[model samples]
Every structure is written in C-alpha cells, then in structure tokens.
Target: MTDTLATAEIESTIRSLEDARYAAVVAGDIEGFAAFAHPELLYTHSNAAVDTLDSYLEKLRTGFYVYHRIDHPVHKIVVVGDTVLVSGEMRADITAGGVRKQLANSALAVWVRDGGRWLLLGYGPTVIPGAI
Candidate 1:
C-alpha cells in the first residue's frame, strides 16, 4: 500500500480505538475494555508510570476504581509507518470513597498494528488546570 493510504488507515483505526475507550469508560464495561486491549499492551500514564493492559484490567476487576464520566476531544493525529499518535484533551468526573471530583487533562496515545487489528501501545497525558 502507498504510504499515504497506510497513514490514513492507521489514523482511522486510532480514532476508532479512542471511541472504544470512551465507550468502555462510560459503560464501565470491563468486558469491552478487555476486547479492545492486547494482552501485552503497554500503556503509560502522564505521570510517567507504565502499566500493562492485563494489570490495568486486574485493577478494574477489583471494583475499586470507578469513573463516573469521561470525555475526550481529539486535537491531532499523526501516522508514521505502522505507528499512529493521537493527542487530545480529556475531561473526567470520578468518584471513589465518596469523594467526587472533576479532572481535566491533555492526552497523547500511541497505537500500533498487531496483525490486522490496532492495539494501543502507549498512552500518556498531563492533567490540565481547567477544561479545554
């Protein structure tokens, strides 16, 4: 395939993955989360810490972390060879231990093709002071 075509395809797939991430967070569906994530997925947070998808799912299964709402506004997408990078602003409302709060963030995600499907390889975001 031509480089342009490949880039387009990768960008589209990255957007789709973002949608899935939103859906899973909204529904709090661990099953949906599992479906979209690769077993060996490496996701890094804005805090500079990294966690595997499996480890993330395990934490979810514990029912300890609950997110009430999540919204992501994409700002950019760039594709290079088999890798796609997405940058966006994120707003989230979360409640845990009876404390509910809002969070604003800027996110960057890296996605790569695994066989025929796209899997998120890395994601990092900085917490912004206010909504974007």
Candidate 2:
C-alpha cells in the first residue's frame, strides 16, 4: 500500500481505539480495556512508572479503582509505516483508594501494526498538575 493510504488506515484504526478506550473507561469495563491493549503493552506515566497491560488492570481490580469517565480528545495523529502516534488531552473521573477525584492530562500513544492488528505498544501521559 502507498504511504498515504497506509497512514490513513492506521489513523482510522487509532481513532477507533481511542473512542473505545473512552467508552470503556466510562463504563468501568475491565474486559473492554483489556481488549484495547496488547498482551505486553507498556504504559508509562509522567512520573515514569511503567506497567504492563496485565499489571495495570490488576491495580485497578485489586485496588477497587473505578474509572467512571475519561473525557479525552485526540488532537493529532501521525503514522509512519507500522508505527502510529497520537497526541491528545484527557479528563478522568476516578475513584481509588476510597477517594473520588477528577484529573486532566495530556496523552500520547504509540501503536504498532503486528500481523494485521494495530496493537498499543506504548502510551505516556503528563498529568496537568492542577487541572481537574
């Protein structure tokens, strides 16, 4: 496929993934979140903590962390071959460790096309310190 066509395809797929993630968070669907992630997906936070998909889910389940909603908007997406990158902003309403709070952040995601599926390989986010 031509680079332009490939980029378009990847961008569409990435947009779908982003939408699904937003919905899953609002629904507090762990299964849905798992489907959006690769088995070994590496997620990094602004604080530099990294977690595999499984580990991240474990923290959510075991800690009784409930993510009720995530208001994230994709600003831009760029694709080069098998790698796709996206930049966006997000606001999340979460309940964790007995505290209910809302937070906002800027996020970036990197996806790789493995086989025929676009898998989330890496994601990072910077918390907007005082934005709620």
Candidate 3:
C-alpha cells in the first residue's frame, strides 16, 4: 500500500485501540486496561500527577478514579517509525478519589507498536485554560 494509505489504516486502527482503552475505564475492566497499556506506561494527568502501569491500575482497582465518560476529539495522528503520536482534546466526567470532576484537556498519547499490537506507552494531558 502507499504510505498515505498505510498511514490512514494505522490511524484508524489506533483510534479503535483508543476507544477500547477508554471503554475499559468506563467498564472498570482491569484486564482490558492491562491488554491495552504498555508495561512501562506513564500516564500523566492534567493536574501533573503521574502514574506508572502498576499505580494506574491500582487507581482503577481501588476506585480512586471512577471514569463514567471519556471522549477524545482527536486532531492529529502521525506514525513515526513504530510509534504513533496522537494529539487530541479530552472531555470527561469522573469521580476521582470520590470527588466528582469534569475534565477538559489538551491531550497527547504515544502508542508504540509491540510485536503485533499497539501498546499505549504514555498519556499526558494539560488542562485547557478556562475550559474546565
């Protein structure tokens, strides 16, 4: 396939992965999270808090964050070598550590192709000014 065609295909696949990963949050599916997350994932929240794979999973497992909704309006997706860089807007509602929150964020996620699958390596979001 042409490069452009390949890129489009990869983009679509990555978007599907993102959807599934986010769905896991709403479903509170631990195994689903594990399936999508890389072993070395570093998820940085809009508030600047960071979570490694283990800690992030614990956050869900212990009900520290109960995500009821997650929506990403992806602006850009690029494939560089074996990595896909995703830039997007994040809008979500969640109860974090038992406190309700509505999050509006500018987000980026790095997905690395591992073996035959895409693994989410990192996620970082900054709160959009005046968008909470």
Candidate with top lDDT is 3
lDDT string, candidate 1, 1-132, tens digits? 987887777777788889887779568898887777767777665456677887777666665447788889899998876677899977787764356777688998877777877777777778886454
lDDT of 3: 0.93
> Model 2, 42-67: lDDT tens per residue?
98855578888988888766755677
Q: What local lDDT score does residue 75 receive in model 3, on the 0 to 100 scale?
A: 96
- The per-residue C-alpha lDDT of model 2 at residue 91 equals 78
106, model 3: CA deviation in Å? 0.6
For model 3 the TM-score comes to 0.97
- For candidate 1, the TM-score is 0.83
List, residue by residue over 1-132, the lDDT tens digit for candidate 3.
899998899999999998899889899998898899999999999889999999999999999999999888999998997899999988999999899999999999999999988999999998999986
| C-alpha RMSD in Å of predicted model 3 compared with the true structure | 0.8
Candidate rank order under TM-score? 3, 2, 1
RMSD for each of the candidates: 2.4, 1.9, 0.8
Q: CA lDDT, every prediction?
A: 0.76, 0.81, 0.93
> Which candidate number maximizes TM-score?
3
